[model samples]
Target: MNRHLLYAALDAAERGWAVLPLRPGDKRPALHGEDVCPGIGDCAGGHRKWEERATIDPDRIHRAWGDLPFNVGIATGPSGLVVVDLDMPKRKSSTDTPNGVTTFTALCERAGQAVPATRTVRTASGGVHLYFTAPSGVRLCNTAGRLGKRIDTRAWGGYIVAPGSLTPMGAYAVVNDLPPAPLPEWLSARLTARQASRALMTAPSAVRASRYAAAGLNAETASVRHAPEGERNATLLRAARALGRFIAWGDLPREQVEEALQWAGEQAGLSPRSCEATIRSGLNWSIARNGQRRVA
Candidate 1:
């Protein structure tokens, strides 16, 4: 009995949150220790961890929504909470200001104290999550630019999307009433200085992985993460101008090769509002408008 995912996983396990199931309209994991993927190329690595069968147990979420119309998720560190997603960008500039509502209103003016209006949700592309709580020991990891440019931060193995869920791109509602915010000791020292500047940019430096393997671009980054779609934006502008000719030969780090060519142009689908302006205009048309034709 789905009943809106069995009363939304028993109202997110009566607000202690943990839930799980997902896979109605879709967000993967509709159970399968035995079988249930009647599609999606029959799962496998396509996705199925269901975060080790997440649960707050209202009778195991009523036998996991009695196997019907699923989608609910919400696990976030055994429910200690910590979401803050905020996505929203499809190309701003109607006078800007919407980087997830101006980075949660500049972290409530630098955590002089504010975040108390939580349990927000909304997302279905327009983006927004909010929630909070986990800050005790502080380890809040899972990040993709934690506080800017389409911000993200989902703590400890993460999981969300559960406000009465539904998806084929729509329906995650809760939109804030309040309850869940707490992590702000100056936003936990600005997320521990953004986790030490992302561990000093992924701790590599054997001369930046030998100049990022001399930008040979391993088969054009596996064809820019499987390009196709009528040559996915000219194969992601030819792999961001061969990662800007390995960052104009100083060998790399134009913000980590434009965050790995915008995560390979979002695994070749692009459209996250022009994936960071198509990798910053194909990395300034190959390092500043064809830097003297990158010297033969």
Candidate 2:
């Protein structure tokens, strides 16, 4: 019956963390996918995603885990937790690049702050997850590498595989027993900036747009968003420079171009500060170089 696993689910529920059953020895949810939903029990009204279906009920937990050795998952948003994921290097043989831990430590140093002491978990792959209480009145979403290289965060619209889960790599384990700390202010500020940047991009601008300009902006932003991890910054810079000519010729507003590119860069996993700097540099260079070109 995997009594230990049942206890793990109850323990998380006791702490108010919404628990879900993961596939046995895997991190994916054990529940049926939306396409295969029976539209009965929980979905009588409509299909509910894993986040909405996650529950802290002891009875449900017992019913789900009492029959199989399924792993456990914690829906971070429902739990009011933001987990910073410091991932291991994708290629163990590649020692040239810094791991998530190294980059995150450097990020804290640059911000003039110490790493927050929080509830810590060691993932099956030897990565670290640092849990923090979400700040009041802010809805932070999942971000991939927005903090630093190989550093990701899960909040709203995201989940974390809880300790007591097993995978091909190894068992997830709790390394630090400390309760989650309130999210550090410096880190919170950065994440808030990310949110604000996205908001600015979506808010309608007063600038009139030509069909050509709109198409160009959409295409360039897509390129930035889908750029390979190693080339994200370069792609953002190239996109900004390419679109700066539209602004230079007065077909697009400077603010609109910058905001769109900024949002795209952030989505591509570049740090917000770095994205802003790169976009600015690219746009300025393009504007200056093309200032005298005549558009007929």
* Model 1 clashing residue pairs (backbone): none
**Per-residue alpha-carbon lDDT of candidate 2 for residues 1-296, written as tens digits (9 for 90 to 100):** 37988888898999999989899999878888656888987898977767888999998888888889989999999999999999888765577888888999999999989988899999998899999999999999777667887898888767889888889999999999899999998899999997777564433353666677777888888899899656889999999899888888777888778767866776665655577789999999999888864747
| Model 1 Cα lDDT, one tens digit per residue, 181-280 | 7876776688777566544543434375563443354445557768655577788777777667666655665776665555555545443345567777
Per-residue lDDT of 193 in model 2: 93
- Candidate 1, lDDT over the whole model: 0.67
Provide the lowest-lDDT 10-residue window in model 1. 33-42
**What is the number of backbone collisions in each predicted candidate, taken in the order shown?**
0, 0
RMSD of 1: 15.9
lDDT of each: 0.67, 0.84
Segments in model 1 whose C-alpha atoms lie over 4 Å from true places: 6-68, 72-83, 86-113, 121-128, 131-143, 146-160, 164-241, 251-253, 256-296
RMSD of each: 15.9, 8.0
User: How many backbone clashes can be found in candidate 2?
Assistant: 0
Question: Mind sharing the TM-score for model 2?
Answer: 0.72
Q: Work out the TM-score per prediction.
A: 0.32, 0.72
